[model samples]
Target: MELFTVKSIGKVCVDKKGTRLKLDKEYIPALTNLEGFSYINILWWFDQCDHSDSRSKLIEKSPYKDSPEMLGTFATRSPERPNPIALTCANITYIEAENGVVGLAYMDAEHGTPILDIKPYTPSLDRVENPSMPQWCASWPKNVETSGDYDWSKVFNF
Candidate 1:
């Protein structure tokens, strides 16, 4: 695979339900200057994940065993994996900052976690229909039911 240099890395602070996360004020100046960007691609490092576990090297059952049968890390969204990286598409509500510190959207990542990269979420290019998922997720529950509340706080902090 080709490697791309990362411009900056940031933490994805999400609530329990996996929604809105807190961004540092330092990022405010850069993200705020842009307009017409309603959504963004969140690239984060799953620092909390134990990459040392050999089991995380390849893949296995859902980290939460009760959720599904065994599967590959690439196949599932489970945080356990070799790279321990997580990516998500989030809607950008608005940018907030004081004194041009630098804060972006609130996401479901932890503080201090490395932000691999941030790109404009282009609907025309990113959105795909009927993409291949996995058998375990064949009948995946709705976001609200699976993770529960779709509220911003719950979604990003979880």
Candidate 2:
């Protein structure tokens, strides 16, 4: 088994929920300018997370502590697993390094998390149709409801 060494980690920032991190988008234009690429694949470490001890342990429960029966960690995006890391496909809305900023939407990562890597999100090679998602993701549960209001302090402890 060969291991790859990373060159560096990019900008660190938290998620809107204040529980996760987001990476810098400043490399996109430079990517397009140099490599003619538009989109990217973002690999980030859920750094604030301490999942090493629980990495081998699997759980079926939802992070919110609600929902239904136990589902495998891989079956659920519980953020608990062999590696407490996550990736997402995002559209690079824009990158303004002159101002030292990058903008991305629909990002689920939190602030200050280390950005492991970024690769162009190539749709030509990456697009798929009707991907099979988990059962819990199919529809809204009848019994599940939300009070809506959320307090970050109570939900996440640093």
Candidate 3:
């Protein structure tokens, strides 16, 4: 097997104020010109799930309310997988370039989670006009904009 090394450019901070991505001083310059974009794709590490056991998990019982009985790790967004990496498209509330802080409306990651990378959310390259999905999830929100108001509780299995 091949090996790779990944370093965190920042960490996620969540508090009463809300979520924020605090980049390392070295990564501050990279945030320049990142403003103006309404959204961004945050690639982060699943710190809590970075265990050997989690990495070995390749399949999972369906985590959705009305999905198949079982699913491969790639099929579901579960953090338990070969590589504990997560990608989330977050709304950019504000960007403090000097402080190297990027305010976020929300992120599925926990506080202190390591940020792998960040990229502007360009619809031309990231958006899919009419992509197909399984019937079970077809009723889900069509876009990230509507996902905020969506009653996700009805879709996720507890």
Best by the TM-score measure: 3
Per-residue lDDT of model 3, residues 35-153, tens digit only: 79999999999999999999999988898988999999999889999999999999999999999999999999999999999999999999999999999999999999899899989
Ranking by TM-score: 3, 1, 2
User: Against the hidden true structure, what lDDT does model 1 obtain?
Assistant: 0.57
Candidate 3: clashing residue pairs, number: 0
TM-score for each prediction? 0.61, 0.61, 0.98
- Ranked by TM-score, the better of candidates 2 and 3 is 3
Scored by Cα lDDT, where does model 2 land? Answer: 0.54
Give the alpha-carbon lDDT of every model.
0.57, 0.54, 0.95
Which is the winner by lDDT between candidate 2 and candidate 3?
A: 3
Encode model 2's per-residue lDDT on 1-158: one tens digit a residue: 57756533565554553222233455434433423444556787666555566676587454432345566787665566777777876555565544434466446776555677766766678776556644544443321122123343343222
What C-alpha root-mean-square deviation, in Å, does candidate 2 show against the real structure?
A: 7.1
Candidate 3 lDDT score relative to the true structure: 0.95
Candidate 3: residue pairs that collide: none
